[model samples]
Target: MADPFTSALVRHVLGRLASEAIEEYGLLRGLKNDLSALENTFKLIQGVLHDAEMKQTKDKRVEEWLKTLKSASLEVENVLDEAKTVAMIKSLAGEMGNKYKRRAFFSYHMNPLMVRFRIAHKVKNMRKKLEVIDANRSRFQLTSNTTSEDSAGIASEISNRETSSLMPKICGRDEEKEKIVDEICNQEIGIGHDGDDVRVYAKWGMGGTGKTTLAQYVYNHEKVKTHFELEFWVYVSAVFDIRRIIKSICGLVDKQLDKMSTDYLLKQLKNKLKGKKYFIVMDDVWIENEHMEKWGELCKALSCGENGSTVGAPLWL
Candidate 1:
């Protein structure tokens, strides 16, 4: 008598095999139907060719009709070849289905004995990786949590932060300024709603539409400057350097040149933006959806005021 577990495994494998066979059979039938259709189309063409001679053709219509019939014949041959391929695939899938069933049955009976061996092997490798990761993480955390022992180092870092805000000078953005200002101030132009909704202004005309300049103008304007509690400007050009972006934002907000690791920068950004109303400027964005996601991550870090709610007001150029 078969063991109960083995019997149950066999039953499950047979059920799956049956299901796969039915699917393959359906596919085979569909392919066979397609082949029949191709055959019928070929027959129809032959009938048409037979009747074409009855019509007296004075011009080159006979030659054209012969050429069309030849083309049709070639098409029918191609259709038959495709149908044959489909049929072969269906047959192969059936054989594979049977093989899978047999393999499953064998594995079900044998796998119990091997499970312990596999687990031991896997656990050995996993433990090694975990140990390495934990060691690295411990070192990183220690470094990150270090106390500032030197006052001069802290002061120098602070001074460096103060001078890093060398914003690119605004140039040739008169038309863009008019458009963006109008969009922001004019309610009819649809910029602000209850001062909560982030009015996204996209300037997607072409390259050199003064997108960056217009963004800078908006960033520095007295109205925008005073309205928001915190402002963050990140240059996310075609090359997506996440570390650089976070560093730039940190420098803008805290005014420092402290070298922050990628992980720490992200954490610091999130902490800094926890409960502040901030406007983040992402300049020179690429024409790809992935760039959008990177921007979204930075936005996620910014504190949007209450309930971490911040509206996405985008001005794209």
Candidate 2:
């Protein structure tokens, strides 16, 4: 799959595509409504593209959907760029000769209508493609929109924390991440029974030993994600509720569990996770088998009892 065009670039260009220049241009009169519709549709897809692009590696349909969106957006960019260039020339038509006037007239009054019609047709087809992708989102197990920036500030905070807690790259840990990655990649990671989940793995040291950072390094490693399709990070802290842990996993995959019975929830969770590789990092697990009973049950459900197995990784406390 092609490396996804960064969301930042799309957001930046789309912002200009929906600019006031397009809205106010007198020559774009017949084109305004279609341009506006295209802009709205683009906006609608922007939030979901993240999710789609994330799954593109796993699903070809998502890959195609993103490609289509990118192609349409690029065409819009080109059209808008042309319109801006024409508008600039038209503004100076008085200084230029009749040749320039004719050019400006064609650009403003005639060319825009054709541009508008073409874009509208493309956008209408793109909308149909989007509808198909939307209808099949559940087939990919997308429980919620993973790519939406629900809170820009919070996202920045999390990004900063994950990258280095707002610090410079002075305390690099490439080797540490590699070590963890090697350990994880060396084994077969899958959902399975207790015997399969019995690997003794733990990161032990004194307080503030950078265990969390080291664990996160492994968790976010590209190889680690390749080994596991479903990834979850839950900060266990002092409160060790198994239900809470299970809920966090469900939230990652966007599974609804409200008012459901325990057996039902487990069954649904198992069905949702069946045949897929998943990763769960129980941060601050405060080592105790007392927490194991519910954890064991979760393990069983995730393993689906029959077709499951597990690969072990460092469990930080």
Candidate 3:
């Protein structure tokens, strides 16, 4: 079976280790040694994460080791999450009285002590697991990927299907980039318009035509950069959820609105973009609506950027 824990899973673990292991505060001093050791061990595996991913296609033992590493990383992340929760509670419980704040001691002090002690034990156990896996790396004969060009030439597209936040460096799209730049600079798009007059521009093409990559390129271009004050890049998969999309956009704008009704979210979004010129890219959107009404509403919500903001989203069918 294809590995359930993909690069995203490993990326999360590596990122957490990078943040937590180096952090010298909030974490109890007693736990620092184990955390440091844990962080170094994870760094060793991080170097091989991508190589292991590719080799597993031809090796069963490597795939099993990847699964084992996934479990170890998950346990480490869980331990850190518990530590963070306790730390947050302690911070929230800033000051406390003696008799009246009985539970406060547990919240601010004892709970954290227990949390650290428990994590120390878990980290030691996980260290043993990792050491065993690292040793087996040689036994399984797994090696690092040293070449960019594989025998198959290379897949036409390398972007992940689920999501891509930062714009990645693509191989060759200079011609397409220039064409898009000309299109945007020519004033052919609705640059300064209200919701009533907005129209969708479709980049028509065939499958595997590099449509998404082209859009990503344009979204980060300098001309596009100078044109809008605020920018948001959101990935919309097969299932369409307006509520989720609104939340995602709000998050990009550095605003977090949780458990909100669709109407409230729309109102908050309207306020958020009331007078700001913004750019938004809703990438890989596939909706299964019987009619155009749902999409029309979605478009309307996007157009709620009242200050002449431009929405450049490439639709893929």
Candidate 4:
């Protein structure tokens, strides 16, 4: 009953729906992997804390092990954030309804699906490693003391007290925070500087380098907050979804995502951002080349402010 154009549109929409389902599956798998990793890490930390000799190490091995656990936990949090980004992308892809060119849709959506799957696989392997560490720590705890109840009770009490204290205050990277904030303040400012080109500041570090925390601090600083008329924060993890990013920005500005074409949404973004100095932070950036290029397209959409207008783009990887 439909015309050729309408039938093609329906096929396109169905294809996009299939892609969204795939993305959701991948994201759910990634979340499972992350949750498993967190559980193993928690068990490992608990086992380590229960060891009597852990507190008596001369090489500070226990401290180093605790630090590794903290880093692993942060990585799990980052993985969860990535899963959320993938879900948002999937949702936007379904809503966009084949608006993007076929090539753009495939490039932006299908390619990142591979990245998410690969990362999920890696997280699963890491989870196995954490489980092994947990087992070893548990064995050490069991064999360390088997004959003395009084001594065991005292050791257990001491371990429990120490863990209670240390659990609340996980180790963090202070120097990294200082350096990142300095770079963002110095390189990501556009309005006050006498430069013609927009300032683009990028922080490309490893996964657990505290990029998100560093950016959060810089984004909330008094000086940084006062410099830009409008500020936008976007989480562009491995799954690079432009429509979702736009929708998120709209939500932040208290706008809805319905009843807008890609072009219309972009226009609204430009109008909202035109002639006003803006600070944009893209956090937890993808490390892959393809994902990075896809993110560039999102940036291009947001960088269309009027000529002579100032825009600060700070990307933290």
Which has the greatest lDDT? 3
For all predicted structures, in order, the TM-scores are 0.36, 0.40, 0.47, 0.40
> For model 3, how does the per-residue alpha-carbon lDDT over 1-317 read when each residue is reduced to its tens digit?
35435444544454455443335336545666666666566555555566687888898888888888887778877876766666656665665445434575566445556656676687778778877777777766555442333211111011234455467788876887888766654445663333353434446443356667777787878987887778777765434546667767777332344456667777777777766777777776542332145456666656655444666656644
Better candidate by TM-score, 1 or 3: 3
**Which whole-number lDDT from 0 to 100 does residue 238 have in model 2?**
29
User: Compared with the true structure, what per-residue lDDT tens digits does model 2 show for residues 11-128?
Assistant: 5344454444455444455655555555555544555555676788888977766666566567666656666665565567757777876664577444545555655565456556
The global C-alpha lDDT for each of the candidates, from Candidate 1 onward, is 0.43, 0.54, 0.60, 0.49
Quality of model 2 by C-alpha lDDT: 0.54
> For model 1, how does the per-residue alpha-carbon lDDT over 208-310 read when each residue is reduced to its tens digit?
4445556667777776656567776665443455666777766644435355555677788778766765656655444443345555565445434333222
Which portions of model 3 miss their true places by more than 4 Å? Answer: 1-4, 20-25, 96-101, 104-112, 145-217, 220-317
Ranking by lDDT: 3, 2, 4, 1
Model 1 bad stretches (over 4 Å): 1-179, 182-200, 252-261, 303-317
Error of 3 at 292 (Å): 38
Evaluated at residue 245, the lDDT of candidate 4 is 69
2 or 4, greater by lDDT: 2
